[model samples]
Target chain A: MNKSYLYLFVRFVVLIALQVLIIDHINLGGYINPPLYILFILLLPFETPGWFLLLSAFALGFSIDIFSNSVGLHTASCVFMAYMRPTIIRAVGAPADYEAYLNPGIPDMGTQWFVFYTLFLTLLHQLAFGILESFYFAEAGIIFIRMIASSLFTLVLIVLIEYLFMSRKK
Target chain B: MRHILAFIWKHNFFFLFLVLEILSVVLLVNKSYYQRAVITNLTDRFTGSINSTYSSITGYFYLKQENDKLAAENAVLWQSLKHGLVTTDTLTTQLVDTLNRQTYRYTVAKVVSNSTGKRNNYIMLNKGKRHGIEHDMAVISPNGIVGTVVSVSDNFSWVMSVLNKHSKVSARIDRLGQMGTVLWQGQNPDKGSLTDIPVHVKVIKGDTIYTSGFSHIFPEGVMVGTVETIKVKEGDHFYDIGFKWSADLNGLSHVYIVKNLFREEQVELSKQVIDE
Candidate 1:
């Protein structure tokens, strides 16, 4: 458990730094900056309790929000996605041996489940964040466009991270 | 209670989702400028619509009060206008004389009751001795003369309307400069007869009739009416001119009382002349 905790702490620091320093600054047409740090929440271990998972997601999102200069936007979206995570896993029909040691990554859940799960949560997070950021029905189209573009970008990056890290660990 | 607690604990993530979402919206409304603007604009629009509806529902209750305020403001304007201090630079015609000193003070009072259909029409004003209203003060609407105060009480005064048979106003034909007198004949409320103009003078239709200021009641040149018709009888010394009553006496709501500061002195001078 201590080793896992250390690993998660390292993962948190790395993903947040990557997102703030790299992903957030790279403006794809000025509105398509990927929310890649959500990978920390998405790849959390399957058997992590709800409160701990939410808290971890909040901490990661709050750091990103502070760095991005938008104080509550990312925290809200990330918390929503964290709350939806357990339901999504249950709906995906996890294997009988799903336990504390099993990370919900490509190596553990395979490419198909990982893609679906990450894409779904990334889309949800992007939708929440985009709407809250704009907060106007007149800008609904712009919000929709940003959500799609940023969700796709975040999904690609999350997939790449899962693939690179899982391959090396395996 | 325990079951409810169990349910909440069981769905603690759902509760957390609700709490966090509410927090986010609160923060967005309070801390964010753009989102707060949107929220406040929506709230203002909603409250504005509600307030308008409320005002519409109860607007009639304030109509009397509002009319009084407007009448009071008009009184102040009339005081300045009747004082004749300010003059336009463009036209140098001597049509309106400039009084070097302020000679008239004005106050507004609402018409509490009026009767135009009666032979002796009288209007009751909502102000009296306490409001500086006195008997024989001139009462005029925004358009023209309405009546003269006949009696006064602590909080009310009666005005003998210009449509009454006994009502008289010293007047003149503006274009001809012929002095005349306006008297209601106790018949038609819309028309008054302008008497005392010499029969040989031209009586043109649409010519304006104005107060001649001979009676010391009305100020000089206040419009009374326009000439509607003229009749000259055989061997009659005066032309009987029918003029439109410029004021809507029946619909009277607000009126100004012209208090002439020099009225008592002028009357005393006239009385001494009569005695001599």
Candidate 2:
């Protein structure tokens, strides 16, 4: 198997395990539930096909929903993030041809671009997830608050994980 | 046909991802009803274990506080015991006897793991099905009511905390006897809202709120909270009353699960007339 594909598979397994076994039970605050599984989508190889990216995102979210017992909320949010990924990437002027299998890194793409990408994706994911989870229009304000709080938490974790672990890799 | 086949082969990974995503969405949207039961059960077990681990770690720090609270509660129980005889000696024994009958029973349990910050906060208690904790049992802290039992296992149970948006408890004013539904607004863990309170009824910010005992889940007079604020819209028939929850759900350590002995029979009988 290709080294990159092997790395992706191992990371995917580890992420899923950590999410279900550890993060799901770690309730930092009433409003903040960090969704680290989203890193699976964020870390995908740049050359991964559009259809594959969208599908992987959905699968990742659906697995979490299944475990958490929330219906369809995660799936919807994951798909929304997947759909928006390309637009954000293009607007930020990252490499167009993604055939080189370049990993998304701050050092490679510059800190500003990386921050914008993470913030946009994290916010989009949280907003879609929170609204769908509430499923009630009357609770829009409460859901928005929850989304913002969770997004902030998730962004911090994402950056920290990337900085500490992925950044050290060759 | 050969060109099409080549194209498909070239994008197999893309197609595979799409298929997986669609499959996930379908599973999420069409989650089997039975799956909910299984997931809830699994969650309860996992939460229970986590809570126990946390409790064990934190138990050392709380021993002094727990001992003091227990001593205080014991004193109250002793005083009540002493008063029971004196009251019976003076009043109409029959009326007082009937009034004194235990309408509710409680199962004491240690909080293994408890949380108040999540949108759907749940507490894990050390005692469970074997200890007489069943679904819908009211879980209370020393201060006041916390939540209702949602799932139970052999050795542990999960209480959906009052902070949860899905929690709804029937409550009434302590002084005026006016009734309303208490619901968590999800804005603050320590506060909730009392809806359907008639505007005409006299209500004040400091008035006490207690469970109405209309719901089989909780007995009458279980302290829920005190009215924090009352907003009566002009021309509206009801007031939006805010409640400051008495139970400090965030710092839960010990809890009592209230079991309604007649709940099963009552539910079965009521089910014959009303679809519950």
Candidate 3:
């Protein structure tokens, strides 16, 4: 248990470093800088307690906000994602999946289930982020376009990273 | 008490989520960069240095472009030193009733971190309070006006860029002398919308814009941008206009923080007048 906690901590540092230093600078078309740090929240252990999950999510998102010099967009979005993660997993997985599996990943959960899980979570996260940033009904069209474009872009990267890195997990 | 405790334990997730979400929402609503939060301050120190380190490595790629721009600006500066074209000294001297008194001071600072990709973009400078930088100072680049200082840490200052939605610059058409406000309505880092110009003004294409110096944040007649496009709808009171900034905010690295020596006096005098 201690080893797993340490592992998550190390992952948080590495992912946050990569995010603020590298991914944040990749301004594609002055629009789609895919915030890849949320992968930390995504890759958390499925058995993570409610308080732990929400607190870690807040920490991760707040760190991003600090680097990006915003306030609550990422924090709220990540916490909301963490809050919804269990429901999302159950929605996209079998009833017996949690009892059978030790974790959530492409390797452990299978390709189809992981993809659907990641898709719903990223879409939802990006939508929340977009709405918080813009806060306008008139620019809903632009927000939708941006949310979809960014979500898909980050989704591909997330899946590819998971497949390459966590391929050995299962 | 036992029942309430048991009930809370039964659905702790919902309660935790609600509390965390509410805290995040409060942070968002406040959105003040200068908030006295230790967590944010620590992160700012870490993030500021990290950004500067990363930018130093990436700064090599833009060396050629930046050097060329500096050289071009040097030529203009050299020409002015030798009385090139019309003397702009007279024009600037007119701002000061007394001759040879400098009302503005400029401090050189490097842009360690900048972003033009957001709805409300910002720039971070290497200079801060220790370097004589303060809040509300004007930051201008060799190319054009950049932003205004919003907050200052020990070694870093945050600048709210002119491209930000909340930023408004009192500007004037150079040739026509028609005054208007320039603001960014989100998107387009290179372009900002010029508003409040009455429809009767004959605003031609390619008209130059300069800071009006009415706001007291920026000095008089700094190059703001140039008129790029204009459209007028029937019966509209003001002309719909967009101007391209003289500075390419994406490529900005070096800038000067403008400190107005007379600003306090001016503001105080205005306040005194208003008190009557």
Please give the fraction of native interface contacts (Cα pairs under 8 Å between A and B) kept by each candidate.
0.23, 0.32, 0.59
| Per-residue lDDT of candidate 2, residues A58-148 (tens digit) | 7677666544545466777887788778777887777766557476766566567777788889999887777656667888888888888
Clashing residue pairs found in predicted model 2: A30-B117, A30-B118, B51-B112, B51-B113
Task: Write the residue-wise lDDT of candidate 1 on B44-83 in tens digits.
Answer: 3433333334434445766886677678866878778635
> Ten consecutive residues with minimal summed lDDT in candidate 2 chain A?
A63-72
Residue-wise lDDT of candidate 1 within A71-100, one digit each (tens)? 577888888889888878777768677567
Clashing residue pairs found in predicted model 3? none
- lDDT (0-100) at residue A32 of candidate 1? 68
Candidate 3 to truth, TM: 0.91
Q: What DockQ does each candidate score versus the true complex, computed on alpha carbons?
A: 0.09, 0.32, 0.67
| A1-170: candidate 3 lDDT, tens digit per residue | 78888999999999999887778666677667687888888888777788999999999999888877777879999999999998997798744745633677877777788778888999989888888887878878878887888889988999999988999855
Candidate 2 residue A19 C-alpha distance from true site, Å:
6.2
Query: For candidate 2, what is the DockQ?
Result: 0.32
- Which regions of candidate 1 fall more than 4 Å away from where they truly are? B32-276
Residue pairs of candidate 1 with colliding backbone atoms: none
Q: For candidate 3, write residues B1-276 as lDDT tens digits.
A: 999999988999999999999999898888554563444456668878888998899999999988898899899888876356675687665655556788899999998888877777789898988899888999999878999998788888889999776799998998988899999867566788899999987998899999999998999899988889999888899998998999878888899999999999999999999999
